[model samples]
Target: MSREAAAPGLGHNGGPPLEDPDPDAGYRAYVWRRAHRKAWKTPPPEIALRRLARAEELGMSYKAYTLEILERGRYL
Candidate 1:
């Protein structure tokens, strides 16, 4: 687990934190989801869509639409 993950749970005094799913399992599915999932750092889908629509209103092509967003996103 990472430090950011620990701080939220660390506020617990002594007895126990909120609760762990299991001693060994430890929120297995939840952890897996966090590990595998990715999120945008810059413009999100809604923002991108708005930009695309505005660009199209200006008559940008499909290639140009994609090109404009290419630099704005990290490769998946």
Candidate 2:
């Protein structure tokens, strides 16, 4: 049998698995994650209190309400 048939796990090319073809993909993903977390940082105490009140009135959890605002850029 050929090398490819000998090691099916190495893929059809018979090379190591190409889980991440792009070398810069990891750094880009890390930057994206950092930005995403920054966007969801805790609001100020007064704003948090207001959002909590509004969330309670709307019968939604604080996290759900906040996620709605973050994703839709609007108050619900």
Candidate 3:
């Protein structure tokens, strides 16, 4: 059935009923995702130059090094 057709909170639950529009929860999630995206995106030119230098010192291309850090959270 379509999502609109499905019952809200129909699954088995032991806790109290959930809030339909939990504004606080939604806002917290939005802020968390926004910060995560900002952290992953390329930085300003000066910072980027530093990253490039570090990547060169690591003997890897800048793109490869950046993707590695973003994915593995550390150098190999």
lDDT by residue for model 3 (1-76), tens: 8986654566646565565766699889999899788877878999789879999998999888878877888755
**Candidate 2 C-alpha error for residue 10, in Å:** 10
| Candidate number that wins on TM-score, 1 or 2 | 2
- Give me candidate 3's TM-score against the actual structure: 0.44
Task: Compute each candidate's TM-score over C-alphas.
Answer: 0.26, 0.67, 0.44
Q: For model 3, name the residue pairs that clash.
A: none
The per-prediction tally of clashing pairs is 0, 0, 0
Task: Please give, for residues 1-76, the per-residue lDDT of candidate 2 as tens digits.
Answer: 8986676663367667758589998999999999899878988999999999999999998999999998898888
Most accurate candidate by lDDT: 2
Worst 10 residues of 1 by lDDT: 34-43
**Candidate 1 ranges with C-alpha deviation above 4 Å:** 1-42, 62-76
Total clashing pairs in model 3: 0
Tell me the tens digit of each residue's lDDT in model 1 across 10-75: 556656646665765758877866744533234677977776677778698644655555656632
Compute the lDDT of residue 57 as modeled in candidate 2: 98
- From the highest lDDT down, the ranking of the candidates is 2, 3, 1
